[model samples]
Target: MAEPRLGQMNASFGEGSVVLRWWEWGPADGLPVVCVHGLTRNGRDFDVLARDLAARGRRVLCVDVPGRGVSGWLPRPELYAVPVYAQCLAPLVAALGRHDWVGTSMGGLIGMAMAALPHATMRRFVVNDIGPFVPAAAIGRIQAYMAGAPTEFADAAALEAYLRRVHAPFGALSDAEWAHLARHSARVAPDGRTVLHYDPAIGGPMMAGDPADIELWPLWEAASARPTLVLRGEASDLLLPETAVRMAARVRVETIPGCGHAPALMEASQVALVADFLS
Candidate 1:
């Protein structure tokens, strides 16, 4: 299939004037859908899924949350919290008028907060591989990896290999998919080393906070009033089976088998599921 038309825009926030970058796909007048990526990940992670939705006549906006992707890094890394992300995204949400939201991991948390806003513009919500209650063990696992991640790699192949190992829990992505991920996930440093694209200091706030299980049940409850779908990886350590069961009471829950932590949602089946729900 032909590649979808892609466009980029920037929105500035805060006194220091941080710029948040986002990519747009499909027709300008098509039904809108906003997508947000997880921590340590940028907006490009939604390329496959966003393209599919765009082809189906939906306008897709994939945001590179502050400190990630090509977006400008914050002057103070301590502001890298979900509340800050949600606040920064408020203008974009308002400008969209009304739209559907697809959030992965940390993005899901931001979606919950946004959906709870008094004037929230989000109509339907799709949270990928996360829940209202994130276990401390899962948080620790992510923190450990982020803390020890290599700053530089020998080359593109080395970076791809590193991504394949660390993100193995993203499930069985094909060779091309992995290559696409690595291509957008890193950039060439002045020294010619392949470095991860995001600001490493993005982890400062997370590490500084207490290592307790993140509890946002209140936000989830408020957001649950809207049409919502929660996708969980069958072997996911973050959104446990019990949590999924509880979430099923308020919103639809679907388990993506053969993965842990999260489902990449690049597969036809996964994309179709999300598209169908939004339709």
Candidate 2:
């Protein structure tokens, strides 16, 4: 199917001085579905899923959370916590007028917080590969990659190489898919070197201990007012299959085999599963 009908708009947070970017697509008034990306990943991570959902008649709201994608780097990366992001997203959702949410990794955590707030707007919640209490081993693995990634590259080819090495979850992409990812991940710097699109500090908060043994259940439990969908990668170390199954609250759960951390949700079967769940 074709990509979704798309457009961009600036979403303001912390006054007019700091404006983040937001993207909207599909029917302007269709049921809204907010698709959030992972920590290191930007909103484009949801492109495949967004287009699919829109094609099936849903408006998709994908965003560049502070330091990623076309969005600008934060003046202070420490402000990279979910609380800051949720504050920014509240207005964006209000502007949307209506919607549901589908978050992946970091995005999932943010959605959980939104669902838990006193008067949340989340019509439905779909968390892809994350839980209230992530495994320490998984956090370690993600930090290792996020700690120091190449910001400069000789060409898009080199950038694609990094994505393949680091984001193996996409696993054996076609040439075009590789190119698509590279184009979204890098910028042709003024000096001609390719640079990553997000702030390096994006890994900051994730590395900080949240001061709790398990911090997700309260938020997940708050989602009781809305139906929830949790997707897990069967072989994912970041989100252990057993833990994901256990997080299965008063909601639905599914797992994709042969994938880790995330399922691309690009294939027809995966799309069918998500679409059916949302419906």
Candidate 3:
């Protein structure tokens, strides 16, 4: 099969004066499929899936959330919460016209909020490895990781090692895949040290928030106007099986066996499921 067309990287200002970056692919006027990444992740996380969808003639857009990837860092770290994230996304979704959304983790939460709005423009929604109720244990794990995340690496090898250790939940990615991830995840500083792409302070708000007090069941329930699909990793601690079952009551649910916190849609079968559902 021919590879999908990759569009030039584009930038636009978002909430809090942050500049958001995104890449477009496939047809210029095809149905839009906005792909959002997880907390601490960038738009490049969706490259594999985006290319797959684009090859099928969908206009796929993968964006970097504020304070992450190539997007501008927030002036105040307190603005890193979901409400702000959702607000930042609203304009982007509006600009794209009616579309589909595929979000992972924090991105899923933002999508849920947007889809629940009284005048949502989403035609279909997919939540990947996240739900209304996020387990405290998962939150704790994420908090610990973000708190102590490495800022500098001596070389590419070191960065790869760190990513493999921290992102193992993404499951058995190949060395080439890891290289692709590392390419977008790190940037060399003026002093020649390689650092992760996102602002380290982005974790400030997350560390201060009590996970138990963060509830979004109302948003999830209100977003039921459109057909939804929930993708869960069978062993995900973030999206509990029970919670997935509850969400399944109103939407389609697909569990990827042998996976952990998230299913990286790098595999053909996984991409096929997402493409088919969006179509």
Candidate 4:
């Protein structure tokens, strides 16, 4: 069979619009599986996973969420939360009819909120290395890096090296994979400088929100009607092991070792686990 072709969709949100880019593969009429990446990452983060799911006879749609990747930046950064994301994603899902979902970090949170919504479009849900009750210490760590930082990298390689230092937990991705990630995550400037692809101000809403003194169990429980699987990195600081166990009460939980806050499910073995769950 020929290599699966990729398709892009533009979801209108106001006059500016929010582009919904996706990669499609496998049979034309196969089950749809939508993959969502983390806060700073793009839909291409699931290139490997998309291929794996495609090969397994699933139509994978890896979305470049608003404010990340090729997608346009949200003019209202204040609407950066999952609820706002779901508002945009709802139409995309409707266009696809119905589809399963896999999300990491912020993406996972988005999927959870969608599943909770009445008359949701999600068929099944898989959360990669994130949970409802995130630890404050881990939140602090993420906030430190997301705060706009100066980058003097001359090219993509220099920027990749810097990314490797900050996101070391993404695991040892191959050169080609790392190259792919860096290409989507960074852009070369006119003056020989490298910068992250999306607007750093996109993080404003995230940081501006007051700390939640309450638990997010209510949000997580809303998706109880669906078959949900939560994957946690054993070394993840964001979702503490105790909290992961607690989330298990809501759905099946699995722990992947030798990983940190988020585990890049780029490996074939990792993708197999997701395939098995979606099956």
Give Cα-based local distance difference scores for all models.
Answer: 0.88, 0.76, 0.83, 0.78
Model 4, CA-based lDDT: 0.78
Off by over 4 Å in 4: 1-6, 12-16, 190-192, 209-214
Q: Which of the two, 3 or 4, has more lDDT? A: 3
Model 2 C-alpha lDDT per residue in residues 1-279, reported as the tens digit of each score: 544444454555464424567566687778988888888777776777787788878988788888888776666767787877887778777777557888888898888887888767778787888887787777777777876688788877888889888887754456777777778889776877779888778776676763223457666777655888888888777777667667775667788776777776766677777777777
Task: State TM-scores per candidate.
Answer: 0.96, 0.90, 0.93, 0.91
| TM-score-sorted candidate list, best first | 1, 3, 4, 2
Candidate 1 residue runs with Cα over 4 Å from true position: 1-14
TM-score of 2: 0.90
Highest TM-score scorer = 1
Model 3 per-residue lDDT at 47: 83
The sequence of per-residue lDDT tens digits that candidate 1 reaches over residues 1-279 is: 455454444544555456778878888898899999999898888888888888899999999998888887887878888888887888788888899999999889999999999978889999999999999888888888998899998888999999999999999999999999999998877888789999888986778765678778888999888999999999999999999999999999999998887899898899999999998
Kindly report the root-mean-square deviation of model 3 from the true structure over all alpha carbons.
2.4
Per-residue lDDT value at 189 in model 2 = 69
Using alpha carbons, what is the TM-score of model 3? 0.93
Residues 1-279, candidate 3: write the lDDT tens digits.
344343332333353356666777778888999999998888888888988888888898888888887677777778887778777777778888899999988888889988988888999998999988887888888888888888799888888888888888887788899898888888888888899988887876778866543557888899856999899998899999889899999999999876787888887788889989998
TM-score of 4: 0.91
Better of 1 and 4 by TM-score: 1
TM-score of 1: 0.96
